[model samples]
Target: MANDGLSAGAAARRLGVAVTTLRTWHQRYGLGPSRHEPGHHRRYTVDDMVRLQVMQRLTAQGVAPAEAAAWARRSPGTDPAPSDAPPSGPVAPADSPDPALRAAAAAARESILSLVESGAMIADVGLGDARAGGGQTIALGPRVDPAARGLARAAMRLDGPSMRYILESAVTHRGVISAWTNVMMPVLIGIGERYEATDRFIEVEHLLSRAITEALSIVPRPPRELTPRVLLAATDEEQHTLPLEALAAALAENGVPSRLLGARVPSRALMDAVDRTGPAVVVLWSQLPGSGDVTQLQHLLSRPHPPVVVAAAGPGWPLADLPPTVTPLNGLAEAVRVISTVKA
Candidate 1:
């Protein structure tokens, strides 16, 4: 991310690709350098380097050049979505774009940005150097909120206080759903992809998750006098509950009170809790395929008086297997809106 920019050879060297390869990317994909001087070849700016990095990484992961270029072009500061409904996927020179492909690439970029610069940023989570590092920094790319940039830097450094300050400030100012989706989700997903690709930074994930849990928990709950009619639990062995936590916090913010069964609730235990509480709505979360058995949903419906709404929330559940009686929640905002009505 050198501000002065890098020449073709230097940029190619940094990317470990031959200069001809760089030329091919530039000529064919519109990924050419933007920085220029009188009587000199254009140089690669920091933003251009970022796009090239995405191109290099995606191509390395077996993505085709045209497809990768679609992604590289969409990244912040390159040619951003300038409309109310942003376009996604790699844009081809002559053919129509693919939504699914573009979305996946964008999601992957959002998820892996932090880990891409982990080696240097992970140790110095501070506000001052949010933009100081050269190559080893979280890549929120251009057009990201400055808060997210700071948070990503803090997360890479694992500076708990700064992260908490930034996260809490975001949640306080923007609310849980916005903060989670815009701030936390990107870094969380980014670090996760890093782990998937490199099998490292579990510590970063653990610390960040803990910090988020703590911050969200501090959001004041509804008055104790209000009876809890909504129940939330993760399916047995499904340990990913951050989304559930966000849902809980969002609901709490909007004045809906509910019981949260943190994680790993067996079918019997879930059923027992539902049977005992007689909740109006029961939200079961499953974060992985192994624990997302539909039999649990079937078992819940078998109860003499199953909760009025049996909501299956999370990506873990098999979509085809979910019975017609159950509700599927795809995001925190939707979950809160749907559950709030039943409880009200």
Candidate 2:
């Protein structure tokens, strides 16, 4: 170590986080460097690095940033001249009163490394196969966000609280669209691929889906004054509803109210819903090809008071067979943009 202290770049490099993240920690949470050399920029002393390591570890374990900062600020060993290197790994808050935090701390380092090495920024890192880690890890590809890594690790461990924390943080901080597109989708896809290849991790998939649904449902809905002119449902025999859930949440984020009929809506029932609600927009989701019958879309179009927009979503739909009036929604953002702008 230099006789002075480490610059911000050096500190971020050592900690495996983006320089902007460190700047956020410094500006918002007050976990900034303390050592100011003669005429150079303030640098992170060994003690400052220790606190940040604690901060990094806790946040990676799905702890909220403000709470993690509070813990980091009070972390022991802030006073004395530190050793040449920061602690080799994350330092747990042993004296914490919260048992859940303590439990998470106990396994945070190993769990973080399972999906992301040394808790580094996720880029071009080939996290090994599930079999390599005793079926407790899922690999996300290059340039993925750290929240995705945390969620993947939590999903593998079946840690509901941590998974919820990571997911909620993503949704709250990044908004529903960014959260769904960046953080949640990647992990979900990785797990789906994992299940397909090995015929395993069904439990993992179920739990993660439940967590995502729970997280998305908490997005505050638009006021009742604005009637929900948008309707969402899955086609007959289509049990997959997570994407629809995400769309609902994203719409809510845009202050657009929507009625979500959930999974496996029969053609008759969906028609009945459309008739009763007279929704301006109706989105039918189909996750598998067999479930996406073009006839269903035809049924909606034939209604006496047909919707302004009848949309088909998910990979199951046969684009060529879709009714001429039906709008094909390729992704969540596009679905939101199309549905939220419809005239009643």
Candidate 3:
């Protein structure tokens, strides 16, 4: 009733929804008002409460949370009418969209999605084919993309040898992770053309992913006395373990001890590992969309125990509607940052 702010818990109570549900709406739909904090607790304004009410109404009517949030933003009487209802300005000549560009973009997106779904590896489409015509040789390496290079520079400061090893492994292995990285090279080149248009980098990419996964599996765990322990693994349906394995290596490099549980770890085994290790974090890697049983996993995660931080990576986590407690691991560098921050 008042415009005064309410904490997330209070607001959730007023809306009669679970706190996880509220946080999900906030993250997915951007429905909540700006958060202001005094000390460390989050507080939401009256506007956010109003939006939540509207969201509830729309959701009850079968509208998705994202669509409901959009509706709430544009509802009548919420804002004044625009000054120009219809512009009478001269219109520029309209040109037809390029079918070739659209096709290329679609093809690239399809390739990436298919690779993730099928667990297809990446292969090097040798630049020799393109270079035979006397064109400049396209360079391929770990820091191949400028953005990835920038990230590498800022994060780990990977040297030429390390970068080369990563790139070579990815190109040769054809693992899904490796393919994603290699494909990123051409995808970056065709950014203006849309993500779907880039050529497939299947074989070498998959090889790289597999190699990374294998390397991480062999990397020794850190000493137990160094810091609080953590367990890293993938969900049962998640065959992609490169991301989690990378995180495990990062933890070892950072002096935080962790056990790499490898890929396709069942929930029972994961819980058993947790019970045995008493870890501070449980990192789960899931790259493929709709591949893991998130609902059941969440129920497992909610149980009382050593307060565990669940870090999720890849495309699957975002679609799983995970609780805010489960943080998204974006990249190798980000994984390091999160673990370091938590340890500190």
| Highest-scoring model, lDDT | 2
Q: What are the candidates' C-alpha RMSDs?
A: 12.7, 12.5, 25.3
Q: Give me the candidate number with maximum TM-score.
A: 2
lDDT of 3 at 296: 36
lDDT winner between 2 and 3, please give it: 2
Per-residue CA lDDT of model 3 for 1-344, tens digit only, reads 22335666656654445567666666665555455557755555444555565555444323445555555444432321122122122221222263322232233334334543563322211112211212212233544544233223211211222333333333334433343444333423332232234443333344434434454454455666675567788888887665666666656666677778887888888877777777777777777676656753574576677435677766676554777667777876677777766742
Q: What is candidate 1's lDDT per residue for 1-344, written digit by digit as tens? A: 34456777666655555667777677777777878789987877656666776676455333567777777776644453222223344575522365433444454454334433553222212224322222334555576665666566556656675577667767887899899988888778777887787777787789889989987987889999998899999988888888888988999999998899989989999888988989999899988888888988999999999889999988889998899999999888899889888833
**Residue runs of model 2 more than 4 Å from their true location after superposition:** 1-135
Q: What residue runs in model 1 are displaced by over 4 Å at the alpha carbon?
A: 1-136, 139-143
Q: What TM-score does each of the candidates earn? A: 0.61, 0.67, 0.42
RMSD of 1: 12.7
lDDT per residue as tens, model 2, 251-314: 9999999999998999999999999999999999999999999999999999999999999999
lDDT-based ranking = 2, 1, 3
